[model samples]
Target: MDADHLLTRRTVLATATAGVAAGAFPQTSVARRLRREPFARAGTFASGVASGQPNQRGITLWTRLHDIGASERLGMEIARDPGFARVVHRETIRAAAVRDFTARTRVLTRRLDPGERYFYRFFTRTTQSPVGAFKTLRPPDSREPVRIGWFSCQRYEHGFFTPHAGLAAEEDLDLVVSLGDYLYEEDSPAKLAEREQSTGDPNGHVETLEQWRAKHRLYRSDASLQAMHAAHPVIAIWDDCEVEGNWAGEGPSSGPSPVGPRSVPFSVKQRNGFLTFFENMPQEPIGSERFRIYRRLRLGGLVDLFLLDTRKYRDPQPCEDATFEGDVPPCLDADRPGRKRVGPAQQRWLTAGLERAQATWKVLGNAQMMMALDIAPTRPVGYDSWDGYGAERRAILEQVRASGVENLVSIVGDVHTFFAGELHTTGRIGSPVVGTEFVGTSVSHDGIEVVGDEQQSALVTDRIVLSNPHLRYAKFGVRGYSVLEARPDELRVDFKGVRSVLAPTSETYLLKSFRVAAGTPRVRPA
Candidate 1:
């Protein structure tokens, strides 16, 4: 990467976290206390609501109070019954200016029965917001089937977020797992046909902490995202674009075309983005800055979903040449300096997590692809993905083999395409493929735009599937979400796609479906 680009990225983010500490906002005036509710309606400014990180015992409720200058004190009422006539737990929390007046509270009430539906909504002033319904995870001791919606790569400007709306109303899922790219920091300018008006912060590019928070606010303001939050809890993690495109820790922004550094080649500023992210998003069991996002959530005994942090601790992506410029040229050498690769610590953590997992289904919530790809292997290639780091990818597969974890399924995003495949330890393993992976296409971002002709695109997809025997399906042009249903004896996945995201309300369609037996790792046609 160029030195100027690296310096520019850092300079833009400096002091962005100012006035962000706890209790940083000034006290409210007496006159405001007596004022009527602001943003009382859910659809008006708050846009939507969401619940996440659910355990059998409790769940976290989230809503942002969208107002200028003043902060709003939001209240939530969770009830077993839909009517507020019988309230289970009522929480009145302060949504201060520091966190964009977003109220994230944990409502611990025994009344929220496991696997049973419950209604919740925010209250400000005398007005009540729209009521949203969600369910709690079954107890750890209970072993029952669970259904979840897994998706990633939701870019705001590329298209509409109709997928979220579809998932919100079209399915009865316990939760939605978002692997990454919840918000894109920099958009693909050439690909955007229309631009969304800037909300509170400046538009162009989001580099500073304020810009990132504002981007999150912009996304949360969407009705579809809020509705999904209202219906079911969301399990989310960040991809490179969430902070920066292909950013690996604190490193040079761009460099040698595909094989560069084996690990982080720059500073600690990259890690700071994760800190800012946790501030806006609701997460649990806060810990040290080093390896925080690599945690596991168990849905009773039916499933154990491991949300991985692929960008945080990984090494800088490598390029094919020492002094390449812009995107790598096709038909160039693959043995260049800047190939993408992961560090040892993250690899070890993933191996241990997979090895120790005892759930019937071990689903990895990964941000990028785990399977090897032949994307310009014979020429100059981009190493920001798994293709950049052969050794690291090999070690990861080896660990999976040694661990012998059954029903290992990986749900991924980032490429803006739908990909289904099996993960093999190596070219010589008995099964060749040890686990199955389903990559969700982008929610709204530009998808397969570079591939124009339908016949040509279909041929490319076919070649990718044909060359990689483990790859069963590939849809490069679809845009949508995924619904994963896990039964005692089988696991089924349905890929739902939206027609076009350029408009607000788009029609949805079923793109494809796949399933795996209780103990099998390969996904068969459902």
Candidate 2:
């Protein structure tokens, strides 16, 4: 590698040094900060409050203070109850200008117990935000049922984030997992105009840091997204839309038919985008790994969620010579042993983590569908998914089969469809169902819109099941998310969606429910 390439590589792997200015307020100023009447009502916490990257002892608390005046330390209060009578932790945290006036901190307090719920809010000298809450992760050996809501692929312009409003209202959720496509990067003049009807987001493709921040700001401004975060702590493993569509590591779109506008050099845009993500969201330091986002979160004693980064370090799209989109040409390179999806380090990390996990359930928080969805008889393969890289996918599945994991579940998104299927050593049957996958549909992105009636929906669902035997349930052309409930012996998922996105409404209904028993490798109606 050239010296520049080598330096950029090092920067990517080095521990992120993102920082805000030192606390401008003196220690005594905290008392005054708290005493001031709450000023920042809805507009101050416009982006909203969020918590993520949780471990046994701690979780990160995030909020972006709109303080253009000067740098200052904000007062924060976290309590076990809404009354604030049982205050767990209180401190002064700084919102640094270097971090774009956003304050994100990894809070580790000994007094805070694991497997518990806590509420948090921020206060400046003049204002206070809405009280948001999150639960600390349980010890891996704790034998309690874990509740998680999995969601992905939301397009703000497409419709209202109504599901988020519903999800926030849910009282029984422990946490939420965003699978990917967190923000849509494709913005044109027309699309931006339509999106502005909801919030003020910059129109056109997101290339610069300003534009990226604008996009994030727009998404966070949505009451639905904010409500979801305010309701339950969410840990997100971003997919392609985090940067550009179908983007692999080290560059923008590749292959013969790449989509989206070409970005700046891989080093610049990747660094900015990744840093913006950390600054904007409730994420901990990525350490020396740079842009890599594959990490593990231990939830209680029964669940280990390995949030895999499928987009950051993947090899180029397979079959560069093929036609665009759905075209599958005779590409001999897909099965090559060296074609990588999660890169070498991340793959090793996930494999080792899964093998070493003692949790009763190892939940792979994948951003894309793990199962192979054959378009078949017309077009055979999909380049953007696991179907493109056959060798690496099977390698993971082979380990799943050989490792004898009691309960391995992969929850995925990105297809804008809902599917509950068995994970076999291969895509075909008789390959041994080693793992199971519950694929949630989009949050607001368009699904199969043609199926507008009950008959069409049934027909579409039947065709999918008939085409893929391992797929027990399939719902195409829907916009919603899934709630995953994991116990020692069984895992149940409820596919919930809204009726319409064109209009603003919060009502959502359960479209389907499936339960997967331990060691069964099949999904049955719940």
Candidate 3:
């Protein structure tokens, strides 16, 4: 946190408590009385509508009112056609400040047939939002091809969200998977200026409930991110940035020299991060908790999507809490019997799910990469990734091989680099290979562009290939997302790249692609 932006702990708590009151959308009585003025003067529905947590029986609908009066009751109208000729589902949703003036309602669609397209919009008094259309997932055991687009790591200040805009316009995807780093919590003059943010006061790293809510609002204000949500059903999982960078269980975020790897206990920030995350996302209450984003999605039994939560419940990094650039001798604590990336309970659950899965393809939606970056024996690699937890990685790969579980692929984000390769049990390239891994580049983060230790493209490619035999593709310099097209027999991934995120009007094209066949642990150009 910037010294200038730091707030007293008492002030932070009081501000959050005072701002949130049931039915009172505004904290100030005067604003509460004048809330209707903003709502009436302009359209109340500014963030638009989105649908997620899609299952065979129902889907969750979400919307945020740019302005709301005291004790306002919003109307939700759903239909099969865009013109609203036939309204199928109608309900009243309460828009209160307790939920940050957002409505997340789940509608059970057993009344309607499955796989039908539906148009939905929200109503406030006399205003009506634009209708959003979404297609339902196909029936069970249908063997229908599933088109999924997964993206992550969009720093609001680094560049435009044009990739999201392009994905919304061009990709006909069944599910939009956001693998985390949805928003950066820190804001600097350089970044703020680039994003055209006019914060007269010095903005610091976010650390409170109010700050979290404000950050969510600012990100949703972007048209590209809003359009992407409105266009498809998004299945999302958070990485470190949502709360803090490289944050493990009950840990602080990683930052520069001042903000050390293990800086402070951010229990408050973590809770607030999750609170705003649920308030913004369309997930229903899983179990009795407001948080907990790790859940599985079934796509007609053709694919079983296991969304894992890597940041929440886990031991700290094994190598003395190091950053992405930090490395040292392996620590004994890494394999201290119970150290885990997904933890013990999640590991058991995932193991059981994979063993009993009946789907043709089992897909793991992960936050960090699985590839063991084979550095020299004298050099230490990044401690914030699976490379830090070598034992856990070996266990999962061994589980996959032991179960004879064919057709497994892990789609990951974070690290802001692209990697298409085979998963080896040990860090050595000669180790036994198990499954396939495709790590997508960041949407707006800085791209490594330079492969290997050298700038020469040919030498870098040759070095990467020779150093890690399991890796078939490697590129660090690019800003884009990945497309995963899954069939019964094979899974194809396209690493789509944009020329520059700094350019608002940049176009997206395929940079590279690879295919992994069923029962084979190899990556080849499609």
- Name the top lDDT candidate: 2
Worst 10 residues of 3 by lDDT: 4-13
Specify the highest-TM-score model's number. Answer: 2
Quote the positional error of residue 189 for candidate 2 in Å.
7.1
Clashes of each: 30, 12, 2
lDDT of 2 by residue, 1-526 (tens): 7764453233322211111223423456644553332322222667889988776678889998874544455667688887565777766566666677688878898878888888988765445678888888887668889999989988888877877877887776778988888888776333344465322233356767766777788778887888889888888888887777677777665664233344455456567678787787787656686655677877887788888888778888777524334444656776678888888888778878888888878899988877777645223346777766778988888876677776889999988989888888765576777888999999888875443688876775576567687888887766888898888898888999888766656568989988988767788999
Candidate 3 lDDT, 443-518, residue by residue in tens: 8877544445555855654555566666678886788888888888888899998888776667888899888887
lDDT digits (tens) for residues 181-219 of candidate 1: 887766444334444634223335555656557677767
lDDT of 3: 0.73
**Alpha carbon lDDT of each predicted model:** 0.67, 0.74, 0.73
Error of 3 at 407 (Å): 0.5
User: How high is the lDDT of residue 393 in model 3?
Assistant: 75
TM-score leaderboard ranking:
2, 3, 1
Name model 2 segments beyond 4 Å from true. Answer: 1-43, 188-194, 197-203, 256-263, 321-328, 377-381, 449-463
Q: Pairing residues by index, what is the TM-score of model 3?
A: 0.85
For model 3, the stretches where C-alpha displacement exceeds 4 angstroms are 1-43, 69-71, 189-203, 253-265, 323-336, 377-380, 449-466
The parts of candidate 1 lying over 4 Å away from their true place are 1-45, 109-111, 188-195, 198-203, 252-272, 320-345, 376-381, 426-431
